[model samples]
Target: MAITMTKGQTGLTGNAAIAVAMKQINPDVCAAYPITPSTTVIEDFSSYVADGKVTTELITVESEHSAMSACIGASAAGARVMTATSAQGLALMWEMLYIASGMRLPIILTNVNRALSAPINIHCDHSDSMGARDSGWIQIYSETVQEGYDNLIQAVRIAEDERVLLPAMVCLDGFITSHAIENIALLEDEDVKKFVGEYRAQNSLLDTDKPSTYGAMTLPDVYINFKHQQSQAIARAKEVVIEVGKEFGKKFGRTYALFDAYRLEDAEAAIVILNSAAGTTKVAVDELRKQGKLVGALRPRLFRPFPFKEIADALSHVKAIAVLDRADSMSGFGGPVFNEVRSALYDADKRPKVMSRIYGLGGRDYKVKDALGVFNELQKVLETGKVETLQKYITI
Candidate 1:
């Protein structure tokens, strides 16, 4: 039977809720390395293991590289594996990250977004995950504690789907959402088990009868094809994401698409954002709409394989789009989301004029009024043929 709760149940922190969801999945092996904001998740899981509530081999690794390496080995041995990390720790595991995805290990990870170090800071930023964006992992950004828990549960299904055997990373803002307490309706263990089903590894290196080499060094001839195959798998995983999300909604009550639109049905302008910023933008969008402004917000839940078509389709009706990026692309053209939105609409017949805005760097608070300000700027761009390149911290 599904777990039932009263309407006014107490709340749980985002990291704690994520730990609850991870326990529901019942991973066979969990190798974790500690990092700020993300450390609490592993800490909670460790306590669960200590209480004998979970029967998984929990390894405490000294570094993130070893954490990912341990997951690869456990997964190769035909066990469902899990781990968590953030920022510089994510950077440290970069090489193994590619290997895990290339070997097609269904390792589910959570990245609490943190600013990568210069003088060493541990605040919310996308630099860490963005650095690994091309490492062949399915990336999903969460806007709320509930969504964070939900995405982590669905990630296993999407990654393990036979047609799309690739790893997935569920990202939530560090400190901002990870450490914030919020009421979240968690799924029952049986429901989660039914949702994820059993882990059946295909081409597992541990198969005794048909043993095969795992991660063997390949020459140019074979390496290229291997990468091509990985790309194809990621491409196919996009469909699996939609399917799993639909199934999750049917089992539970909440549902989210790759890109969710708020008041965009008939709007002249909209601001596209990801992660927790979407929640703030929704409030601003509603306020703007009430004042006779046709403004809306687009939140992309799935960031990898990017939901390009869905985003393009959703923004087709709007005259102009303001892409709000949490992390700036300092060396390149603009922020990650800005580049993605531009790429998605490049081929659209009725593409809307898009502008980029960088905000919330180093874990700065993004207020609802900030979103309203973005909408106002978008209105100006739509009415007149003028737009700013990059607007940072607009005083509203």
Candidate 2:
């Protein structure tokens, strides 16, 4: 379907863009608590609710856990629900995070990426979102404020699809993208409302004629099957994500993919990373291309289901590749993204010699030079046909 959006550019931070998206969608309920970086999302959204800008029910919850619990309840009761959190706030809602997805509530959450506490630091990192990677939620990472807003709009459709009624996380780097202002064009409210459409749940808990049960205890025999069903929902969601992305692009002129591939075709070496770092990597890629180098980058937008085959296919032709992780797995093997990328290429017909590089923990600066260094390392690995270290840290 073609959508006509009014063209108007505005400068907004990632948090403000998210709030703008929420105001456009005007979900039935928003249950959220305040946290650094992410706090602005709920704060601005609350102001919209107060000024009569939107008709959403703004639930000022006491804690992140309660916020998620309330979202699950509202979703179960057939209301379109949303919430936002970061770092420890997301960690606190871990248990309920699984419950929301396990119940197939189709709740949408905006997770501002932050480092999980040990030293109690509040900075941008992938630990929080990566930690919840296995919680049955579809994850979409954003590289800029524009993508953050675009992802949030598409997230609603992806989550509420009848074939894939699962929860989704629209994640953006804390402070970096969340607080940094950038120019972005917003779609008309009527067009956004028309594109998002009205939420139509298949089996709502509020339906009186056809009663249903949620969260019922299952025996050992059926538990595995339920888990498999949840797995299948996400598997189906991959296709829905692509379809929604295509429609969104056709309407908004911005195309999205499971992973954004930059100059990857016919490249002999590449670097794989995620989030805002991809923006920096692109600058490096462009510079290297001028020297007739076959260097490229692959930034994964969808992380949960992994898009194993698609990723393997994209990198199958490259001779060497570097996978950069913003957070460490500490599993002695490699970072989370590294492990997954390696596993995806394990059985490829023409697999690339892959290396892992961990960078940007606790908001460390990752510059274009750092990305160029990784590309240079990949070029070296390609020329030597030998892997020096399987995993190492990239110092900026």
Scored by TM-score, the top model is 2
Off by over 4 Å in 1: 1-10, 390-396
| Model 1 lDDT-worst window of ten | 387-396
Clashing pairs in 1: none
Per-candidate clashes come to 0, 0
Worst 10 residues of 2 by lDDT: 1-10
Query: Cα RMSDs of all predictions?
Result: 3.1, 3.7
Candidate 1's C-alpha lDDT?
0.88
Mark the regions of model 2 whose C-alpha exceeds 4 Å error after superposition. Answer: 1-7, 208-210
State the lDDT of candidate 2 residue by residue for 82-163, as single tens digits: 9999999999999999999999988999999999989787889999999999999999999999999999999999999999
